[model samples]
Target: MLRGAYLILAGTVIALPLTPEGLADGPWWPAPAVTGTSSGERYHAVEPRLADIIERREKAWKAAAAQDYDRLQHRSARLNRLLDSAIGVLVEGEATRARRQIRDLEDDLRTQTGELARLRTALVNAPASGCADSGGSLVQDVKCALMPDARTSLQADIRAVERRVAELRAERTRLLSDLTGSLQALGIALPASDLEALLVLVSADRLIDTYAAYRSLAQVNAALIRAAEAADGDIEVLKRYYGFHVVLVEICLHLHEAFLEEIEGKWLPRLAVLRSEAEAAGQQARRLLAREDAPELRARLSANVDANGLSIQAADLYAEHLRDQARTATERWAGLYRRHQVALNTYRTVALQGDVLSVMRQSNRGFAELVRLELPPLRDFESTALRDAVAELSERLRLSKL
Candidate 1:
């Protein structure tokens, strides 16, 4: 009976309005204690700012849905800070419950922020015309203006998020549970509860940042296109489908270009640098090719081939594949050779005062000596390959002509 009375008394004390500073022992009273006249008045006072934060968060979320990544990022950052400030002032008891709610909002914000950072990084580093969407231009894209059925599907996604968010807000303890559940349904494994604490502090607007939503939109657009293609009846729907397809293709092409740049700039060059060590390895290859035809050379080539465990096709395609690889290498090397030639010419003509002897000397530098020692066979290999590709490509062309 005494324990029950104490529980009732505790509840009653928690329900009362917070007095001025020193009365409540903190800057703000907890949600559980926000019942009496003063607390209600205080809640009403701050409610408008909280509501504004909510509005900003929603706008950011919508902008992200529309692929307005820039606006989404800006608004998301603003919302997060505001939410943090609002949640900071509450008293401990009911405050803990409010904090739990705040944690949910922050987690969404942090996730969105991470997503925003990824999108921005992609845009910044993306090849060509850079920014995917500037000042809502991407919103003008056909994919954003989906047909009625597609729009209906998107609305369903929005409603699902809204419903989930509402359920979390209804009971503070369910916030993390709701998020974990949603992620699981999406086939995403969330971090452990302790790790999730960091995410919980993120601002409201940031909730829209790391955009799983755009990817979702793209998926929906693709599905709608498939559906329309199956029907093949509605002209209007077909038009929308084609428009969306064009946008998808354009974005895909840009992504491909970015990929190509990475290969060209980073990966392909490493291959060249490795192969440069063998650039003049052609004399050695010729000897091997000749030996393939010669009894002694054939013996050596066959023995070496066996020792290396290389396929027999290496010999059969030896000249052909070597030619192909060499041609590609030379086409690339030509760019470097051209730059070097220009530098040599500039030194010879401009610095050496047009002396042909000086130009020859410039051509045969210490670098040539290094090449002589290190890669004497490379140039020879390249020359042999070039001769072969010309013959092969010419044969193909001649056959085509025939």
Candidate 2:
């Protein structure tokens, strides 16, 4: 009964709004302290910023129902745009392969041409002096003449070389034509030079860089034409499936925005207070160390100074971490926002004016992927653990794999 009463008293003490200076017992600075308001509540109290995020997330959960999902058709269109982005990457890859083969063909053609030239040189010079043409001795010339099929053999070899060269040239031509047609079907044109550069990037497997190089030109003038020609069911499926995900993504964006705001406003401030306290404590300790005569007091002050310095260093690192998280989340939000605007604008365009999900728009860098940055020191809605929807959204969709 006495323990219970003490717990209630502790809870009441903790219930008051507290500050870093007010909480003289310093553990509460970084992680806060347990509210011992009652035996039932002998655990750490949630920070206001964190509590606000939880409240916002719960509200979003209550509001965003699957059936109540707004803009399914718009989401579907976004899905198609993402699909086109992925297909564009694949089409770029195919062009890369085609160009590589062309280069190989060009090399083969050069080799065969050189061989043909050598054979022709040999044929013309053969009958005149036989082995003598090649600086052979008189005895060798005699042996060369003894070989009656030498001229015929050379002619046959020339014919074989001619045939192989023709086949390679034909194959190269067909590949070029088919590659061009496929690209045209997807409303793209790979310039020979750009194609070469793209091929090199592809050889290096630079996915993000290739996206930068390729840009917004990859669209679907006639996607079905290409799809039918290539048997790309997977690409079609992405267009069909991920449209549903955009609804959830919008909801998660709200959660993420609240998360970022709390970090910027409160969580960061709390960290600042902790760091300031450490620095102030250290400075005071250091000054005392300079004046103190007692050996034990000096030792204690020196340790305090060291501890405070470490605390300041830790605060700087945490500050940097918070800023990075904010920047990353901001970029992601911007990308998605830009993409949605573009998707909406598509509705006013010629193609999508009448048909919503009939086609995809030309996307900027936003087409790459949607990646989310994490906010540290989470409580309650640790999205990854609780089958949270945001964790799923945070994943980078490998457009190339799609």
Candidate 3:
């Protein structure tokens, strides 16, 4: 019946494309494909905003370089403040974001200082060919004559801003990961699997380290998030999920290891009980057939009656109905055996999840060993540093092994 149901479902699905008006004639069960929905769009939109801000910042910086000393001072101060705001805003309240912004700012500041130094040098080396409109003061004439130097310096400053803008653009490539981490830390509500989201974030925030792949971090976060979500936001959720998943995994492994146990412990014994009745039924039916000896009775015995004394010849004929008048225990048991086979498929699906965890656990152990090797020697390793590195991994291991 189940096979027939699946065949019907399959036929319906295959016929969908052939129906007039596309999906109009299809069954109501198939969900319509909604193409425009995408959660990642929001993240992509934010990237352009960051890029624009960086661009405007660079423009203002160039305009500042061309103005007088007083103007340059004021404009530079404003640029600094704008950069500070950009760091805070772009980070969206993440410590790692803050750190990255700080690095960018430091580079910008360094470039600014270099430009300032170059401008000062140009002013000092002003040519004897004085300013065309200067009245009397030598300094005034020199300033006027070196006006082009100031303009050159301003252009260079503009280029520096452009470079900063480029850096900001590169930064966005990893912004999604940083944002996800920050959101997770801040307890922001986002609709998705936490593990899936964290993996996306980790992939976005990938490091340059060759030994460590972004996937490793993603796996760790996925396990952590799954544990937390499974526990429904409880601190102990991690502990319980790990425990339950591990136990489930162990049970599956044991089952696989001793598959014969099912036959030895249950199936064969049940079959014995079923077989005894079938054998007795066969004897009775044979005796009945022998005594009758009529052609009709002999034909009935061969077609409808089994050698095992039962009226039904084929064992499967008793699967659907069994009147109280007849004893076809063995045939009934055969039905139970077939049903058990069908039920075991569900068990195997859950068992596969446990197998996934086992594989991940082994991989994690190997990676953790590599991380240990990469850490500083004992003299360089501070207690706090060592403690922090292992804290989360140790917690995970404890939970998984439970």
lDDT of each: 0.33, 0.40, 0.31
Q: Which runs in model 1 stand beyond 4 Å of their true positions?
A: 1-171, 194-211, 231-236, 246-402
Q: What would the per-residue lDDT of candidate 2 be over residues 251-296, giving only the tens digit for each residue? A: 3233234335545655466666666777789889988999999999
Which candidate, 1 or 2, has the higher lDDT? Answer: 2
Per-residue lDDT over 135-249 for candidate 1, one digit per residue giving the tens place of the 0 to 100 score: 4665444444453233344445556655655554455445556655543432234454422332321111111111122222233333433444454455444333333322222
Error of 1 at 370 (Å): 45
Candidate 3 deviation (Cα RMSD): 37.6
* Per-model TM values vs. the true structure: 0.21, 0.31, 0.20
lDDT of 2 at 232: 41
Model 3 lDDT, full chain set: 0.31
TM-score, predicted candidate 1 vs. hidden true structure: 0.21
Kindly indicate the candidate among 2 and 3 with the higher lDDT: 2
**Of the pair 1 and 3, which is ahead by TM-score?**
1
Q: After superposition, how far is residue 244 of candidate 3 from its true place, in Å?
A: 16
RMSD list, candidates in order = 36.7, 28.0, 37.6
Q: What order do candidates take by lDDT, descending?
A: 2, 1, 3
Worst 10 residues of 2 by lDDT: 13-22
